[model samples]
Target: MIRVVLPAHLRVLAQVDGEVRLDVEEPTIGAVLDALEARCPVLRGTIRDRRTGRRRAFVRFYACAEDLSHEPADTALPGPVAAGAEPFLVIGAMAGG
Candidate 1:
């Protein structure tokens, strides 16, 4: 199971506490996210758009050294995340005027 740490807002939105664990067959970012959303229905629109299927503008994913910002759709996620050894941190990027 891949460990996922959601931001506080997302946790509140999902009505869940602590870290979320998801079992992924593909060991990819997309797969991990899918499992997360599946487990927490209220998280559906928070991380991604219901129709567009894109990462929400405010949320960002980080793992090890990879930015994964422009990575291909099929790009494999970090090995630790894949192996469920480390948590995939889903943080909200702060922006200011």
Candidate 2:
């Protein structure tokens, strides 16, 4: 099982609390997001673009204390994340003047 920690807004949108657990066959970030979308259709376009399937600008991805927001979707996640030891964190970046 792969663990995913969604930001507060997304958790409210998906109507879920705390972390979400999912079973992903491939250990790629895209696969994990795909699984997340499949399980929570309400979050379809919140984390990623619906047409382009790209991650949102304000959304950041982290795993094993490493930033993966700029990494390719096909890139393999960290071993701890793939092994379900560490949770994949999706953070909503805050910006203000």
Candidate 3:
């Protein structure tokens, strides 16, 4: 099971509490997001673009202390995250002037 940690807003949108555990055959960001969206259909357009399927500008992915926001969606995550030892963090990036 892969553990996913969502930002407060997303958790509220998804109506979930605490970490979300999912089974992913391939531990890639794309696969993980696919699973997440499948499990929580309400999150379809919140994390990624509904048309382009790209990561939203204000959404960031992190795990094992690495910034994965700019990484390709197909890129595989670290072993600790894949093994459920660490949480895959989905943070809502802050932006301001």
Poorest 10 consecutive residues by lDDT, candidate 1: 65-74
Candidate 1 lDDT by residue in tens digits, 44-95 = 8888788987888888888775576555546788888778787888989899
Q: Score residue 71 of candidate 3 by CA lDDT.
A: 96
lDDT (tens digit, per residue) of candidate 3 on 2-52 = 999999989999999999999999999999999999999999999999999
lDDT of 2: 0.94
Q: Report each candidate's C-alpha RMSD, comma-separated, in the order given.
A: 1.4, 0.6, 0.6
The TM-score between candidate 3 and the true structure equals: 0.98
The candidate with the higher lDDT, 2 or 3, is 3
lDDT over C-alpha atoms for residue 14 of model 1:
89
lDDT of 1: 0.82
Best by lDDT: 3
Query: Could you tell me which residue pairs clash in candidate 2?
Result: none
List candidate 2 stretches off by more than 4 Å. none
Residue 54 in model 2: shift from native, Å? Answer: 0.7
Positional deviation of 54 in candidate 1, in angstroms? 0.9
